[model samples]
Structure formats: C-alpha cells, structure tokens
Target: MSYQDPAIHRYGQVIGLTIAAFVAADLLWLPFSNITVDSSNGVAVIIAGLIAGGYWLAGAVCSRMARRSRLSKVWGAIAAAFENIAIFLLAFIPMSVASCLFMYLASSTARPRLDAYLVDADKALGFDWPSALAYANSFPMAAAVLVFCYAALTWQIPIVVLWHACVNGRRRLLEFCAVLFASSVLTAITMAAVPVDGPYLYFKPAASLYDHFTNAGLSHATTVEALRSGPFIFLISKTVGITCFPSFHTTLGIVITYALRRTPFFFPVAIVNALMIVSTVPEGGHYLVDVIAGGLVAVAAIVGVRRLADHGRRIRTALLPSE
Candidate 1:
C-alpha cells in the first residue's frame, strides 16, 4: 500500500498561504518604498516556475504510465522524487523571494539599533565577542572548517530534501520544510521593530583580527545600510542575508541537524552544523544573545509545527469523520 502523510498537504498550505500574504503585502507596500525589484530576478523566478511545473507534469505523466517492468519502476521512483522536488521548489522558492522582500520592507521602518543591548546581554552572560573573534582567527584549519560549515547551509537544504524524496520520507521532509518557514517567520516577527547592527559592525573588530577568519557578516553591510537609510534600492538577484536578532543561519543549523538525524549524514552533518553555530557567532557577526535566541526559535518552530500538524489532523477528523 502507498502511504501519504496528511501533514504534507497541510504544511504545503502553510507555505502557500504564507506566500499569498507576502505577495499581497508587496502590493500594499511597494508603492510606499519606491523600490524596484531587478528584472533579472523576475526572469529567474519565471524560469524556476517553468522547471517546477515541468517536473510536476513529468511526475504526473510518469505515475500514470508506470508499469510493472523494471525500467518503469526505476523511472517511476525517479519521477516520484521529481514530484517531491517540484512541490518543494514551488513553495520554497517563492517563500525565499518573498521573505527577502519582507526583510527589506521590515528594514525600511528604521527601528533603533539593538546592537548595544545585544552586546550588553553578551557581556551580562560573560561572553566576549572580540576575544571570540581573535580566538577563531588564530586557527587556520579550524577557521576554514567554520567557513565551510557556515557555507554548508545553502547546499544542505536540497540534499535533505533529495534524501527524503528518495527514501519516501515525505512526512519528515514536509515537517522539516514547515519548521523552516515557521522558524523564519518566528525569527522575523520583530524585524522592523527589533532591527540590529550585528556584532561585527557594532564591535568594529580590527582588520588584523579576522585575517584568517572569514567574517561573512561584513559582506552584507552595504546592502543593509542601503535599505535602512534613504533610497532603499536592492537587486533581488544580489540579495544577501540580513536578519540578525534570531539568526536564520543559526536556526538552519539546528533544523538541518534535526532533519538529517538517524541517517548517515547525521553525524558528519551535525558536527559541522554544531560548528556552524559557532561559526555564526564570529563569521556571521552574531551576538551571543542572538545565537541563544536563534536556538530557542529553532526548537520552538520545530515543536510548534508538530503541534500544528496534530491540530490539523484533529480538525480533519472532526469534519470528515468517515476516515
């Protein structure tokens, strides 16, 4: 028997509804911000949309034509995987673009910088940001490892999706995906309200401090300032990571590890992801408080998604009652 998880559809709806709201928001806010989304981004989204649609169509056709033959079975499995990929791409790609827009729009509000309080909180916790950066920069191999792990988040997502699609781990895949959206929303809930300058810019760490350590956070300062100040202009194709309070990188570290658990990728990936959080503190220029909050947000998002799925099941049972 073929088993399908109900939560897959439910979580898909979470993304669908979220993207709809985001699009509606863009319509409402773009006029006020005087922002122009780069044409290249639209072109990319169109191409991605076509590819997603093609994958879905191929999946449908393959499923219908799949026969008992060995080749057909192999093609069927591949098509099924493609179908899962299509599902993720359809929801996630839009979510990604929309969320980026949301970040900029949130920044336009020009909230007061929270770097002082964040740094103060770090001091209160007896953590020294400069000392940590110096320590990280002192080791070349370890710094390289941190750089690799920090960069791993971008690639790790698709790999997890592919793993689950191949293994028919649909529920796990959707749950992880839901956790992603949930964490993003949870972290960005106070974006405009709790704007932060981040530790690297706030501390103004000396040039010599990060020679060996690649501080990825320094790269986005230009774009962040562009949005925060007047004349908010951004090229969508060139959008960078902007959130700091609840670092999305930190959130992904936890959720990615959670998704890959019990698999061969778990130990190595988890070790890297563990180090990824450490990397975020120095490389991403996040305060110790940001890391702590991000960890809490990730755990909350994961647990919250499970509860939402359960609540959805209960609602469905009450309505259908026939199943």
Candidate 2:
C-alpha cells in the first residue's frame, strides 16, 4: 500500500478506537446511574449508520472504477472523499452521543458546580458578561446573525464534506478529523473533572437572552438538573451541552476554521467562527473563562495531532520506501 493509504487508514483506526472508548465508558456508567436514554437516540444512531454505510458503499464502487479506469487519480480521489465523509459522520455523530451520555453522568457527581469560579475568573480578566449580554440584546439583528453563526458549528459538517470531496486532500482532512477527536477527548476529560452550571444558569440573564436560550432548544440547564438531583427522563435526541469549563462551541469554531485554512472559504469561516465564539456567552451559556480555555484546548489539540501525524509518518518512512 502507498504511504498515503496508511495515513488515511490510521486516521480511521484512531477515530474508531476513540469512539469505542466512549462507548465503553458509557456502558460502564449507565447501569449504575439513574440516567436513562430514550429510544429516539438509538433510532437516530441507526439512521446515521445507514447514511454512513451508503457513503462507504459509494466510495467502494468509486475505488473499483478507479482501478479499472484511465482517470485513476480522479476516481481515486472521489473514492477517498466519499470514505472521508463517511468517516467523519461516523466519528462525529456517535461520539457526540456517547460524550453527551458521559456529560450527564458527570453531572450526577456531588462535586460543587464551577459557575462561581468560572465567573470570578471572567471578572478577574475584566470581562463583564452580563453587560456584554445586555449589549448584544440591544442589537437584535446582530444577535440573530450570531445565532446563525453559532449554529455553524453543526452546519460546518456539510461544509467539511464538500471541502474534502472537491479538494485534493488526504493528509489535511485526516489532521482535521484527528484534531476534532483530540479536542473532544480533552473536552470530555475536563468536563468530567469540572462540572459547571454555566453562566446563563448562574447569572440568569435577561428575558431576551432567555428567549434566545429557549429558541435554541439546548436546555442544558434542564438536562444538568435532571441528572443532578431530579427525576427526569433523558434521551439522546434531546442531548444538550452540559460541559461549560471548556466551551465546546468555541473549540469547534476554532478547529473548523483552522481546517478550512488555505481554501477560499477560510477567511469567511474565520469571520463567522469569530462571531460564533462571541455567541457562546449568550447562546452557549458559557463563561468567558470557558472560551479562553477552549481556545487553549484547540491550540493544544491542533499541535498534538500535527506532531503525532508527523511522528507516525517518520516511523513509516523509516520502515519502508515510498512507492
């Protein structure tokens, strides 16, 4: 196999291993906790599996055609792109489910919430979250834009799929996905260690911001509450962000923006994600500290993945010559 082939395969294996770890963690926790996931999430997982399977099948067909055709590179690229899309969907969606499960499980801990500490850190940094939120509420149009931009965290998946399919890339795409997995693992670890009630719940911002919260359908407070000290039914379809120590929205905004670097879309993504980070305070129910820590986490994950990829490539090169 080509050196390039091993890189892509390694990316897939790493992601698969992480997801399996997440699954194992959830299984270990579920039986002991009062939390129960509804059937909706299982059904959603099934649907996602079907979609990813279809992409993989298409990629296989493309690969077969590439082997027999004159335009081998083009066909091979298409195949790789399809497989990358499938890998992304499989990695992101289910990992999300399992991680969400772990988040709720973490919330059940008796450890004190970190809202005060986080808010105090924000204050120490001279960041006024309440005032900032009020200012944002004044400009409804701007707030709307922020909301859309924040939602870009989810919408960017399709953009990634398109980018990979259209662009000639294997290494870049793998690095992007690997960074996401790394960031997620770090996010999960930190979340499990430090559970927060989030600034929105702690400060209880204005009715306007509350409306923004309600409309977003995140309801992280409710989920956290249910898991902490209430009798509530949790479902996978109803997953919301409960981890606030490292603002995942912020992490995603940074990571996704970085992934699009060198493309025409990079600057636009950077601008949107900049706004997305701003929205995290109001829409994401996060503290300023969370955003700062999230940026740090993003940097760490990016550097870590790049170094790991480089090291892996070096080992492979030392073992065998390129075809």
Candidate 3:
C-alpha cells in the first residue's frame, strides 16, 4: 500500500498522539512537580517530552495537509484523542509508577545477595565491556539517536495516522490498547518479581566506558552531594544504580516495533530500534542473560496482549450483526 494511504495516516496519528500526551505530561506536569531534575531522572522525562511533542505536532500538521472527508477527519480526531487518553491512563502513568515501585522493592529484597554476587561477578567480567557500554548508554549517544529517530518518526506518524483514518474498517484501536495494557501489566509484574541490578552495576562496573560516562553521572551525583541533600538524592542515586538482569531498552524497543508492525514506515524504524536496543548490551553494560530476558519479556507481552484482543474481538463479532 502507498505510504499516503489513510489507514497508515490514521495509525500514525494514534501513535503520535499517544507519544505526545506522555511528553506533554512530562513537560507540563511531571518534571518540576512530581519528579526533581537534580538527578538523571529528569533526562528521561525530557527526552520523552521532546519526542512526544515532536510526534504530536507533526501528526497534527499532517492531518491538516491530508484534508480528508469530514467523517474521516472526525474519526481520525476521535481515534487520536482516545489513543492519547488510553496511553496516559493505561500505559504511561501506571507503567511509570510500577517501574519505580518495582525498582525500590527489588533493591530491598535483592541487596544482600546482590552485593555478594557483584563482588564475584566483577572479578570475573572486569569493567572494560561495561565501560564501553556505559559510553553507548550516555546522554550524547541517546540524544543523537533520539534526534534521528524523532525526525524519522515525525514524518511517519502523520502518514500512519491518516491511513488509519481513511481505510480499514477493523477496530484495531481497541486491539492495540488491549495489547499495550496487557504487555505493560506483564512487564510491571516481571519487573517487581525479578528485579536484578543489571550485570554492569552488579557484576562489574563497565570500567572503560563507565569512567567516561560515569563522569557525567558522577558530576551530577557530586552536585547533589555538595548540596547536603538527604533522602531525595539517595533515592535518585539508587534509582540510577540498579541495572539487574532485564534490559528495558530491548523490551520497549520490541514493544514499539510490534505496535507499529502494520505500518510500512515501521519497517525501517523497527530495524533501527532493534539495532539500538541490541547495542545496549555492550553499551548499557548488560549481560547476555539480560538481553535474552528482555527479549523474552517483549515477546510475551506482545503475544499475550494480541491473544486477549483477538478473543475479545471474536466474542464481539459473535454477538453483533454485520452491517
């Protein structure tokens, strides 16, 4: 199908709006109020906001350019709105909170065993790989990737949104939502139960790259320390410290790929995302086990959500008459 197809455009719109809402929340509400910027937590929020805003704005402009039938436009707007609402309440907020809670709970539960393990693991693995991975994990690399990604996704989001707006009578939105919710829930549960400070932090510091990237984190840490901050700084540091078995970068990359699988533009995006995610192993100081676990989580989440959505659709179709 042509990239300009309405169905593709509509899908883009939904994804764009979904991303935009999260970004807007971070920029407008979450950063200064709910989360403090003294630590690197602010970096995640900032990136989310920028990417989301860029996608949302780009989608809006594309919608205007498409100038489809009134009904199509209305449906597109409704879909976009619905997607934004669902993503915020169902995916973004809950997932964020759950991730935070899981990290804390995992830390408390695993600290004793984890500390001892880290000593041995560090001796065995050393820190060179971890350090290189740390450099890859740094702000500069992430920023560069995000910038490139946002530029590409910006153009693609509009195309997908408009396409969905125009063609395909299937109720894919509900299906998409069902999958997202289930995947997020599963991820949260797994995160809570299997929290491990990833290999780099636990087994060994990625010494080489860690030394380079650690400087930024250390600088940030030092600034906070100089202020004589108490619990908040500690909390932030802890949040940054743990990096156990699972690789969220891989998991989320897979999720995004699955979510956009139906769209043509998703092809290139998915490939790039997959590469970026896999690179996290060496860049983010994760072990092979971490990457594997992350990939498994991603697959499970996608499959579980899809199955549930399919079942729901079957039930609905059985009850409803065809128009």
Candidate 4:
C-alpha cells in the first residue's frame, strides 16, 4: 500500500476501535444506567452499511470491465467513482457512529454545564446572544429561511462527501474525511468537558418566531433520562442531542464551505454557508463563542490534514530508490 493508503485505512481502523470501545462502555454502564439501546439506529447503521457495500460491489465490477475492455474515458470515469465508494462510506458511517456513541457517553455522565462561562465570554466579546435572538425572532420569514438553510446540514455533508469521492480523486476525499473525523473528535472532547445546552435552553426565549425547542421533536426530559441511564441508544429519527460547547453545526458549515471553496460555486457556497453559520445563533441555540471555536477547529483540521498528507508524501518519496 502507498503511504496515503495506510493513512486512509487508519481512519477506518481508529473509528472501528472507537466503536468497540463505545460498545464496551455501554455494557459496563448497563449495571448502573437505565438507558436502553434503540434497535432503530442499529437498523439504520446496517442499511447504510449495505448501501455503501452495494456501491463498492458495483464499482468493482465497473473497474474490472474498464480494465478488460477497450480503454474508454467514460467507463474509466465510472469505474473511478466505484473504486472510491469504500472511501466515502468508510469516511462517513463509522465517524458518524463514533460521534453518536461518544455523545451518549458524555451526556450520560452529567457533567456540570459551562453555559454561564460561554455566556460570559459572549458578553465580553460584545455579542449579545439574547438581542441577536430577539432580532431573529423579529423577522419570522427570515428566521424560517435561515432555519431551512441550516437544516440542510443533515443532507449536505453526505452528499458533498459522496459527490467529491466519486468525481474528485481519492486524495481529496481522504483528506476531507480525515478532517471531519479529526474535528469530530475535538468537538466530542470539548463537549464532554464543557457540556452546555446553548442559548435556547439557557435563556428560554419565548416561543414566537422561533419555536426551535418544539421543532426539534425531542423531549428534553426523555433525552436527559436516556443520557443518565443504561443501553445508551443512538436514535435514527432523532439524532439531535444537547450538544453545545463548540458548535458542530458551525464547524460543519465552515468545513462544507472549505470543501467547495475551489469549485465554480465558491461565492454562492460561501454566501449560503455564511448564512448557515449565522443562523446557528438562534436556530441552533449556539453561543457566539461556540461558532468561533468551531471555526478554529475547521482551520486546524484543514491545516493539519494537508500537513499530514505532505509529510506522508515526503516519507514515501524518501524511501524510494534514487533513479
């Protein structure tokens, strides 16, 4: 395998190991906690796995056909996409599972919230979260529009990763996946340590233009109970939890923008993603500091991934015999 191949494979290995650890933790916590595993998420995971596996199987067939028949660019392109199917799936599913697992573990522990500190920081930075929220609530139509744009995050990540993995080269896909996973790890750790519920829950903004609390479709009481109990189920239909330290949504917005930065739609992508980030304040229940931390994480991931890639290339080149 090439240097990059091992690096890419390591992502899968790490996520798989982390998943195992989560399972182990769940089992260990079963004695003391009341959380029960909801099989729905497991079903979702299985379905996703099967779909990704199907892509790989189809890609392999196309790749073999391309190699055997007359050289054709169209077929080759198709085959290239199939070959990267594994990269897309491996990058996505496992990372997602690990995130959900870690989130459950952290929240269940019931660590003291850092909302007061985040609020103080926001005030110090001259960012009035409540005023910002009131402004958002003032324009119902605008808030609605922002909410829709922000909600795009659910599909945006998978679509972008799949599109790039198929159309772009493996290196870009690998780097993007690596960065996402790394950023997730950072966000999870920060959340576990500083566990804040965000401005929405903190301030209890009146239910008017923004009814995010209801719109979220989650019962805060049930969610808290699940966190404190055993089985620690990751629900498929309701993935949102009480995560608010460094805003993962804001981080995702920056990452998505970064992913599409070099494309022809850079300006439009930037504008839309900027709105997504801005929307996090009211719609996502995020503090301003959360957004800032998320952006910093994005920058770090981007830079770190590139540096690792370069270092891998150097090591690989050095090991090769001189001409």
Candidate maximizing TM-score: 1
Candidate 1 displacement at residue 103 in angstroms: 0.5
Q: TM-score of each candidate?
A: 0.91, 0.87, 0.52, 0.84
* Colliding residue pairs in candidate 4: 33-230, 34-229, 34-230, 35-229, 35-230, 108-227
lDDT of 1 by residue, 193-282 (tens): 688888888889898998876758787788777775677655667788888887778889899999998999999888888999999987
Worst 10 residues of 2 by lDDT: 209-218
Off by over 4 Å in 2: 1-6, 39-41, 65-77, 208-218, 231-234, 320-323
Error of 4 at 126 (Å): 1.5
Candidate 2 colliding pairs: none
Which consecutive 10 residues in model 1 have the weakest lDDT in total?
1-10
TM-score for candidate 1, please give it.
Answer: 0.91
lDDT (tens digit, per residue) of candidate 4 on 159-236: 666676567456556666767777777777788788776676677766764653234412244675666654565675
Candidate achieving the largest lDDT: 1
Local accuracy of candidate 3 as per-residue lDDT tens digits, 100-174: 533433344322334344335544755344444555656576645643442343354334334443443234443
- Give stretches of model 3 more than 4 Å off: 1-91, 114-178, 203-206, 209-243, 320-323
Query: Where is model 1 more than 4 Å wrong at Cα?
Result: 1-4, 68-70, 314-323
Ranking by lDDT: 1, 2, 4, 3
The residue-by-residue lDDT of candidate 2 on 1-323, one tens digit each, is 24356566666666777788888988998888888778777788899899999998999999999999999999988888888787667777888788778778877776887778877888899998888777777777887888888887888866866786556465667667778888888888888887887776777665865454334424666666667775556677766667778988889889988988888888989999999998888777678889998999999998887776667777878899658
